[model samples]
Target: MTPTSSDTTASPDVSGVVPPTVTAFDGNGDVDPDATAAHAQFVVDGGANAVFPLGTNGEFALLTAGERRRVVEAVTDAVDVPVIAGVGAPSTRETVANAEHAASVGVDGVVVVTPYYYPLDEEGAVAHYRSVAAAVDVPVYVYHIPSKTGNELSLETLGRIAALDGVAGLKDSSKDVPWLAQAIDANPDMDFLVGSDSLLFAGLELGCTGLVSAVANVFPELVVDLYDAYAAGDEDEAQRLQSTVFDVRSAMKRGPYMAGVKTALSLRETDFDVGGLRAPLRTMDDAQRAALETDLRELGVL
Candidate 1:
């Protein structure tokens, strides 16, 4: 359906037609709103239509619920841009609390990942999302990334939430473009986005409404260029840019994604620090640093 006009024009499901997402960090690894705001404006200035402040790259898992709220406040107030905060956590109660906090802070929407740490059955997962959706008035977009959460959102769950008024969208970051495309196409009213840059070449062509690509955090212009190219029907140009994005996205698998991302920001020495990573994860050594630097140099990120 097209957007209605009072002499009007159509608009997409989410606030941003092309969202350039970033991971915000403080000097001591704590969540800092001011730094987040600065990073967000940088993305906005790069021509990204929207800014998603906290996601996997933001290290949402490690951040306390209170810290997440602070980030939501920081990024939303930082720019006139739309901020979608990640509210997914282990328990429905905690997630709902975070969602409520997000609503109180005035974010455009909340991105809730599926239930993790318990491997809930389909019914339990459905109940988890429904609980959060019930608590808040804003749009609730489901995050379907089984890789990190160990809990998957089946297509069946997607269909159930698609019928809800408050459940407006889904960001399937599983890196499975075909499945995400299918899940989203099943419900036209639900805004669908693939949270990866690797398959963006085929993804945009399949009807995704926006992108929450982590790579976009490093190269906002390149991501926006791909989106603009497609909107202009310049598929060839978009693909070329998207291919470069996919190559860079390979860093996630080579080692720790957060380290590489934070390292890249640290390389800029722009005073934006993700706070030295949490346990089970360590800082980068000189060799890893050199490897990333070499790659960033090739990608022109450094």
Candidate 2:
């Protein structure tokens, strides 16, 4: 059931596990809308609280603007859950346009990462987010992933962005728990979702509302289980599930970042094919796959 204009509503409580979903491609390396939608539905049916298309794991960097919009459109149409599209680009104008396009496609929100390639100061960062928030009616989330983007969102910058009227939340991928803690302290009303699955337990401990994990692409239930257990005050259960998530994550990290996630999805034997990583990132070789298979078998995730 594809969501229409009327169905585009912001998620009131965007807490819990949300997968930064992967992009599915055809044998020709073109974006496969059918496969993309199917994968989105797969994750939602597997217990994803929301589906995050066009995220880092989704190869947002490699896709063209039209492809990005199509990915969002397909994912939003496939799932009943909220769809948060990653609209981050190299420029504010592009980012704003992407967010606006995503909004038109019926996404519940857009996650904008800091501009990469060029370093941005606090003022520039604030202005970038301000422009995007002003350009879109849907919720805008600041995606703080410094390692890839080379731009960091300082606490003051986060506070400024949070003050924007259309800004809804933040996704911290910095992996710096202390910085995330300070950002949370700086903006008490803002919703913070961690990007690293390894920090799911720690992020929860630090009052994070949710996690935007790559590993969730392979094991949505584990991420959701950890969040649910923690939310239910089952500390022991959360810890156990987190340990399992860590195991799976460790296995994937052994290969190229996003490739391993796609490979694992393929190994799971889902109805839709995740295929290989987009160019510039190669799929795992036989040896890497064997190691990952060994890890998955030992953990019983396969």
Instruction: Give the top-scoring candidate (lDDT).
Output: 2
What would the TM-score be for candidate 2 when compared with the true structure?
0.95
lDDT to native, each model:
0.72, 0.85
Give one digit per residue, the lDDT tens place, for model 1 in 218-253.
Answer: 677778888888888899999888878877777534
Clashing pairs in 1: 5-8, 29-275
C-alpha positional error of residue 208 in candidate 2 after TM-score superposition, expressed in Å? 1.0
Model 1 quality (TM-score): 0.89
Can you write out model 2's per-residue Cα lDDT over 211-253, one digit (the tens) per residue?
8888888888778888889999999999999899988988998
- Per-candidate clashes, comma-separated: 2, 0
Model 1 residue 190 CA deviation (Å) reads 0.8
Q: Candidate 2: lDDT of 153?
A: 77
